[model samples]
Target: MSTTPVSEPMAIDSRSGSAAIIATEPAAQNSNHSCRDADLISKYDVSGPRYTSYPTALQFSETYTEATYRQQAQVNLKQGIAPVSLYVHVPFCQNICYYCACNKIVTADRSVARTYLDYLHKEISLQSELVGKYRPVTQLHLGGGTPTFFDGAELTELMHLLASHYNLSDSEQREYSIEIDPRTVTQDSLALLKGLGFNRLSLGVQDFDEQVQRAINRRQSVAMIKTLTETARLYQFKSVSYDLIYGLPLQTPASLAETLATVIDLSPDRIAFYNYAHLPQRFSSQRAIDRLDLPSAQQKIAMLALIAEQLTAAGYRHIGMDHFVKPQDELARAQQAGKLQRNFQGYSTSLAQDLVGLGVSSISSLHASYAQNERDLDAYYQRLDRGELPISKGVELTVDDQIRRQIIVQLICNLQLSIASIEKQFAIHFSEYFSQELLALQLIENDGLLSCEGDKVIIHERGRPMLRNICMCFDRYLPQGATASFSQTL
Candidate 1:
């Protein structure tokens, strides 16, 4: 591991002392990326795609078919590509949470999941045949409506099927992660997961306060989280991450401050402080939430400020965007090494260039294109039953798309963009190719968010908080009209 301390440039905040600036170096390792410009945050906190993918999933279309994905797979196999990542989505949830935007099937019927599991295995087999059976998988993530919603035997069968068809890496160093709902999994169930080869666990604990939990209809207790975390540690899971959302209903500064204090005390390996995007029109479950109960934009910003202060004070490294980690965690390590990657699965330490997404609404990102399984479970099963890949939509990258992707990835993941590197990779004069963009970025530059030297564009401390705004300066496909489809960046 590289011991060279990282020097991240950051904006200073008066509220949090020096920990508000420059979240870099071992001494300041727990410092926040301290830009506290609420005015700027509010001004630039417009709806935008998270850019987990450069083009974003908004560009995926039905035009790019299963044949296109198959061709890409064949090309990958012929070239003897590196080990790929696998993302399996389990869309079954026993109940719905009001804040959820994920594609899910909510039901009381346990039998529904059994059928879904059978189809998931079939889809896995079909993908293996195209991508070549037993190709090494360096990273595997089981995400869901709730992955632990299935019984132990179902999960065991799922893993067995994966092992049988895919070259599942047994190396302890490889990442095998699963998302678990604390309300669903017990200590024995966690043990079952550890036995089945999952080493990383992400627990969904939106809030521990009973009021907030009740408002969101996810009534998990603080004790539930405490016990589950302790159990995960007992099993020696490599990493345990807790997920929290800031801008939800009933999230007052005092309430959230208490929540953060409790979370910090627990001291999970990683934390994701998400800004809840309340789009009732887009996600039906959200409609059930009373709009009047939702926090105002100003309150949301305050909640974010509290998050920055509390987490940084508790000695957590603000990795990027809404993610934080212990200074020694792989995510922090990856950030220091410039090897961190942003994908549909958020930040990943995996070096694999290709990711095969299995199950409903999952997305597979190839070298030159992106594919998504059908969002509707019935449609997804219908296609698989017909012995066809369930790729309902996708998009192939254009040359310009590829260039923009490289630039955006470097800037978002590392907080800096080397003009020469982009120029060399894309074979274009940086200034010449992005002349209009540079002209537009004068707005950001003038606002003290970033600085553009002769050969590099460096995100200034003030710009760190509005990283999305800085990244948006390079998005060529951003719609000029209304932006209701995306979430607020702050």
Candidate 2:
């Protein structure tokens, strides 16, 4: 949310582009030791913020009004207004995947999607007007309960609508991606997506084991995903990403190994190997999953290690927490060039400083503030029907918030923190400003999880799996025992 620099003193980004932090020679193999440390796993694998945004969305309050959101939208955010990224959250899904924790509506009726698209038109028009209509949209992502829920004609309409409202880029360098459910897309739909200017594909292939699939209520075959992967390449989609999850309802190292073997044969350009967090109380759909069937903590840790070892051996570069990419992928290149940044949508190429999120329950990241649309369907529609922004809650970052945000994002993305660079940028002594937080980190520093010397906080291999716990020390809002709401780090 901290959009701009304070008097140009606070460095804008942690990348080498800014005078903030310099990255160490990052090795994908560094994290192989993380899962091996039983003590390390037991001590630090607790609930905490993922640091996609500092002052995480939990800090968002209703007091932050639509007026404040509008004011910031009109103000050209940090670095003199370059291009912006767009994230459109489609809320409707025909069937529910029990493991999913995203904001979505599950229903058999198809009419709801049509209704949602109509209201999206009004929201898109309003958003384009507030944020500049001419600002080149270099990045566009369609995330959802299921973005592929719409038919070909409906999806074509959505792309056309976005093009009309904003200066959607046709540049080869642009990143236009969508999240797809393997069951929802057809050969024609996949072709239509490529024709519609989406160059990237992120497929949700939670697991390939049919039994595990049935246990989670998502029954897609490895053959189905194989066909889709082949078709994606034939259509010349720039990147194909597969989202795989571990610690599911019915899974073991042997089953996961088979799944990974199938995935490797179908080699996606990028793979996000996620740690499954079963919080049944937080999500009703997950209640269907029997807790007894879930993998043990030790097994989950072994699974994580297996993923890292297997992917790296297969020549995929592990980028940040859960993402693994081919050496030639844009993400790997971005990391090497120090142009990577983490957002609500995992890791990004840092093409734009501001990301505009539209549709119900979507959150937009402006330079100084974060804002969200009405979370409830009725509330969202009623506000839009009255020709108003469907805002609900958000938070504007303070100067202190900005400093900690850079620290967390740097540690998360690059695996190192440059304390001297941060001090120079924010015009404060890092040690003195964060005296208490430093003390909290000392215990872990002694454990050799991280090296917090005079000017650097370098996360070693053992610390990679504990990234959330490391970042949690800097969170002002996340006090002790307040982690009941979050998922485990491992």
Which prediction has the highest TM-score against the true structure?
Answer: 2
Q: Lowest-lDDT window of 10 residues in candidate 2?
A: 1-10
lDDT of 2 by residue, 313-377 (tens): 88888777778889998778777775667776667775587888888888788878888888789
The whole-model C-alpha lDDT of candidate 2 against the native structure comes to 0.79
Off by over 4 Å in 1: 1-38, 480-482
Q: How many backbone clashes does candidate 2 have?
A: 2
Report, for every candidate in turn, its global Cα lDDT versus the true structure.
0.76, 0.79
Q: Root-mean-square deviation of each candidate, in angstroms?
A: 6.3, 5.3
Residue pairs in collision within model 2? 3-367, 3-368
Q: For residues 140-166, write the lDDT of model 1, one tens digit per residue.
A: 888777887789999999999999888
Residue-level lDDT for 204 in candidate 2: 85
